[model samples]
Target: MTKADLVENVYFRTGFSKKESAEIVETVFELIKQTLEAGDKIKIAGFGNFIVKQKATRRGRNPQTGEEIEISSRKILTFKPSQVLKNAINEGAN
Candidate 1:
């Protein structure tokens, strides 16, 4: 779901006004962004961990032109779900 959908869920569940819910959602997202940008990880219990990983420069090919190129190093964000979440998902598949 999109952010708007999440805001709506929070509004209904927390009995917060739409504006307040929106603010809360936005603030949470902003905080996550700030933390990741600062090279920190966020771990939410029963959910998952957000990690920032640095990738080294590598060689790649331009798909269209078949020309070789150097891919610059960069930082990427990744998520690893908690065991609780993994178990819950697996249970649902049964």
Candidate 2:
């Protein structure tokens, strides 16, 4: 779902005005962004974890030219869903 959908969900669930719900949703997203920027992980029970991982520089081959290229090191964010969430999703799929 898009951000607007989240805002609408918040508005309905919390009895807040649309503007307030939007602000609340935006604030939550901003906080998550800041946390990830700081290289911190976020863990939500029964949901998943947001983790930042570091990768070292490596060599890779360009598919088209068949030339060797250096891959720069970088930090990446990854998510691992909790077992409870996995089970819930599987249950729904069945």
Which pairs of residues have clashing backbones in candidate 2?
A: none
Report residue 1 deviation for candidate 1 (angstroms): 1.1
Best by TM-score: 2
lDDT of 2 at 14: 98
**How many clashes (backbone atoms < 3 Å, residues ≥3 apart in a chain or on different chains) does model 2 have?**
0
Report lDDT (Cα) of residue 84, candidate 1. Answer: 100
Candidate 2 lDDT, tens digit per residue, 1-94?
9999999999999999999999999999999999999999999999999999999999999999999999999999999999999999999998
TM-score of each: 0.92, 0.98
Model 2: lDDT equals 0.98
In the range 1-94, model 1's lDDT, one tens digit per residue, is 9999999999999999999999999999999999999999999999999999999999999999999999999999999999999999999999
